[model samples]
Target: MAYTISDACVSCGACLDSCPVDAIKEGNPYTIEDTCIDCGSCEDTCPAGAISAG
Candidate 1:
């Protein structure tokens, strides 16, 4: 499963820099591509508790 960003995201762009696979985008919730490695790095850095495994 890939990690996803929820509507609670603040779009602060913190998860973008934490993703090792470059899966995160620069939108409201940000986007995680299917190519995601499922690493929790992004989740750990999310301020809004938006990143999760799906």
Candidate 2:
């Protein structure tokens, strides 16, 4: 599965810049790529405990 950002997202825009696939978009909670690498960088950069590897 792809990585998903959850409700804990603070919309800090960290994950948006980190996603290589350009999956993380600016939205209510943001979204991930179905082509995710599961690199967990988004999770690493997230301050709100939002992103998860699926």
Candidate 3:
């Protein structure tokens, strides 16, 4: 499963650089595209602790 970003996201863009597959998109809270490889990189890089396994 891909990682999901919750409403708690701060739009800090921290997770963007961490996505190896470039599956994260810019948005209010940021979004995980379908190409997400289920890697935990985004989750680990999220400063607001908003990304979770889905």
- In terms of TM-score, the best-performing candidate is 3
Candidate 1 residue lDDT tens string, 1-54: 767789999899888888888988787668888767887999999888988887
TM-score of each: 0.86, 0.80, 0.92
For candidate 1, what is the lDDT?
A: 0.84
The Cα error of candidate 3 at residue 54, in Å, is 1.8
Identify the candidate with maximal lDDT. Answer: 3
Candidate 2 has its poorest 10 consecutive residues by lDDT at 31-40
Give the TM-score (vs. native) of candidate 1: 0.86
**All candidates' lDDT scores?**
0.84, 0.81, 0.90
Q: Name the candidate, 1 or 3, with the larger TM-score value.
A: 3
Sort by lDDT, best first.
3, 1, 2
lDDT winner between candidates 1 and 3: 3
Of the candidates numbered 2 and 3, which has the greater TM-score value?
3
Looking at model 1, residue 15 earns an lDDT score of 87
Better candidate number, 1 or 2, judged by TM-score:
1
